[model samples]
Target: MEDRKLTVRAVERALDILLCFTRGSELGLTEIASQIGLHKSTVHRLLTTLEEKGFLIRNPSTEKYRLGIRIWELSTHLPVFDESATLLLPAMERLRDRLGETVSLYLRDGFERVRIQAVQSEQAIRRVAQIGARLPLSVGASSKVLAAYAPPEVLRELLESAGWPDYVERSAYRQQLEDIIRIGYATSFEEREPGAAAVAVPVTGRSGNVVAALSLSGPVSRLSRETLVEYAAVLRETAEEMGLMLP
Candidate 1:
């Protein structure tokens, strides 16, 4: 538990096991051991400890492990979430009300995008972005904005890895990222979910580097191209104000 260089072996291995799920939502004992290069016995023991601490859960039927609610609880405590969520709630609510759609704030975490704050539409049927939800950084408008603005090496690594859809050409994908930056926003239509559409703008920190994405989401039936274009302008302006509040 020391802040110094000496990392406790058991703790390190436990953290590594938790990280294994970042690639996939669930993993069996053998799969985890193979990925982390550890023995089944060691993995099982660590998994047991993690489960007891409420950090992981095992499905009784499938026997696969997945991250537990404790992870979600911890995510709420992250400094970025703690600070930004409260600071931006008013803006998100206003944006949501004005746009008549769901507005969400997404933060990039590893190869995933986390929804730290959200204001849902008043309509009976609307897109709901769950707080603490972790989604692939390869899809959706917010995901594109977040990944596109990540550090160069990080973006390059992502571009060469599992982020892009198999059918999308790499060269064109790179240009799209450039366009998102040059145009100051991004858009996705049913990329992550069927019938869903979204527009995103970058939220920068004090460093003038993108720290998160502000996205408005709705059903395709409502968010037509013209509507999205108008939404982009509002979102871009709101994102700029939100960025000023970020450290």
Candidate 2:
């Protein structure tokens, strides 16, 4: 007989329910159950357990559920999710201090890149990335670097799923990936959102695989082609340093 699984899938489902609340919303039980495809009773059990742990709170009058304070305390040790940012913040700070530009850390999640950490420059003009913001895979410097350096299977799946929409369909997205590989970084402007220009470089683990992307972002006015080229080199060096420290 196969070895018994260590953890119950119900517990996993419950955790997923808690994480979904990270969007900062109040959701009713039906909505939560529907999202995760669990029976009402199952979701209720999960919610009750989570509530006991202070991970979820149910409104008495509204019957809505929202994340609880215990999650904040529990999440302090989420190294896998926060490691890219936590490990790189000091370097990002230094980059901002030296270059007077904003810096952010991104990691690939399925077909998207998520900005986990960002620090703004002290300059009168600055760029900011809202933490937990998600960006599509087909656009922007960070996404390109992620695509280029990601595992081959991940790259293939991401490109296949992205569907090459007209927004990025005009550009040779494949060729762009090739260039990102050859050049060791990527630069793009207004591809995902207008007026934003960015440069991104890969952060490699000890095994020499890219695990994350470190990027500099600002308005196109300040981050011209020449400026981006210069920033790319800085980003690559910094990211390489940060990657070595990863567990």
Candidate 3:
């Protein structure tokens, strides 16, 4: 069978409009239209359709559009971000207690890694990666772990979206990520944020696909490279055990 030559111009335009409203900037129809180079009427029609479907909503007072709760509901069904987090939380909790360091379950969300669940360590000096915190995928132990295990296509897509940032040299970052995959885990100190250090290992599903990452983090002094390397074995063991228990 041959593929059909289908046109998705309108659909692509609608998605582009939705992408414009990110991180608290609710956009008006004209703004969205201008950004996407679509006529106001076309954008309005697309927005109205999306609003009726509960993917977008209009503010009566400001007349601006923002993403609706339904999108959040749908996001919860993503197996990697939601189910993997739920499945790994118990193991993460136990690992946190055993290691006496912050433990987090993370999954790739677009160009960032999202901390779906984090157990803060009860130590005099500890690192804190808040739940829902988004970190760039090209930096840090958790992010590197996720990127190292991700499919080639997915990693390519994320890098393109992230653009070329100079925070870290691109070639060195790529080499680091390659080393992470070779070692089956990753460790970083003060890469994404100052005063933080962490190590992370990939968590695979029963089908042997990387679904999430498990990490232990703390202050650089406490979670030194040697300490992180020591805990890396524990993280890998715990993640493997959890993978076997998932449905």
Candidate 4:
């Protein structure tokens, strides 16, 4: 209990020190100690730790410390969607209405793609994948588009872990992943389930990284391979516009 209290106090002191920097304000060790009303020895130790962790940067010539890029990296989460369903409803609905097919948003989850948001087509016969449905990263247009943009290590881990069948040659599958990235979109025909077809495109964040996949799906009877090109064009525009909504 005593150790926990000490840890809490240390965290509080670190936060207080961080809060001392006002916008565009840089300070030396003594100044920070004075502002936080702490002794120089204690403050200097904390400052050194912060600098080492990239939370603060020190100017070699000026010997002054300034808030560092690490703060901005953490700040990027501030505007992110807390409930993606509510945030993505409008975009999903627009696609459903325009394409007359199910519109779903799938985010990568380890070696899987989980549908986080969806708007089912109003048509009598339609594809209906419930929200939060988890599917393998190795199948479907949604998963393929996501896999194409995943970090090399992530994709490598997925391939190594999945234990694919002989029909799925690793080299050929890798080439297909390459094509998805090169073309900026992917299409599936009976990939995940028989009679199901979909076209998916990546939703890139401000950093140009794929954050999610926006896809339109329906029964092959209605959404044929021929229409994928046209639907993909629409999805590209919608996904690009929706990307702006992400943090």
In lDDT terms, which candidate is top? 1
TM-score: the better of candidates 1 and 4: 1
Model 3 TM-score relative to the real fold: 0.66
> Model 2, range 75-134, lDDT digits (tens) per residue?
676774545567678988998777778898888998889888888867776776767777
- Candidates in order, TM-scores: namely 0.72, 0.70, 0.66, 0.66
In candidate 2, where is summed lDDT lowest over 10 consecutive residues?
1-10
- Whole-model lDDT values for every prediction: 0.87, 0.81, 0.81, 0.85
Best by TM-score: 1
lDDT for model 1: 0.87
Model 3 Cα lDDT, one tens digit per residue, 62-135: 99998898888987767655365666677788998999999988878877888888888999887766666677
Poorly placed runs, candidate 1 (over 4 Å): 1-77, 162-164
Question: Would you list the rank order by lDDT, best first?
Answer: 1, 4, 3, 2
Model 1 CA lDDT for position 171: 85
Worst 10 residues of 1 by lDDT: 1-10
Looking at model 2, residue 98 earns an lDDT score of: 73
Give candidate 3 misplaced runs (Cα > 4 Å): 1-84
Candidate 2 versus the native: TM-score?
0.70
For model 1 the local lDDT of residue 144 reads 85
lDDT of 4 by residue, 90-181 (tens): 98888888889999998888888878888989999988877656777887899899889999999888788745555566787799899998
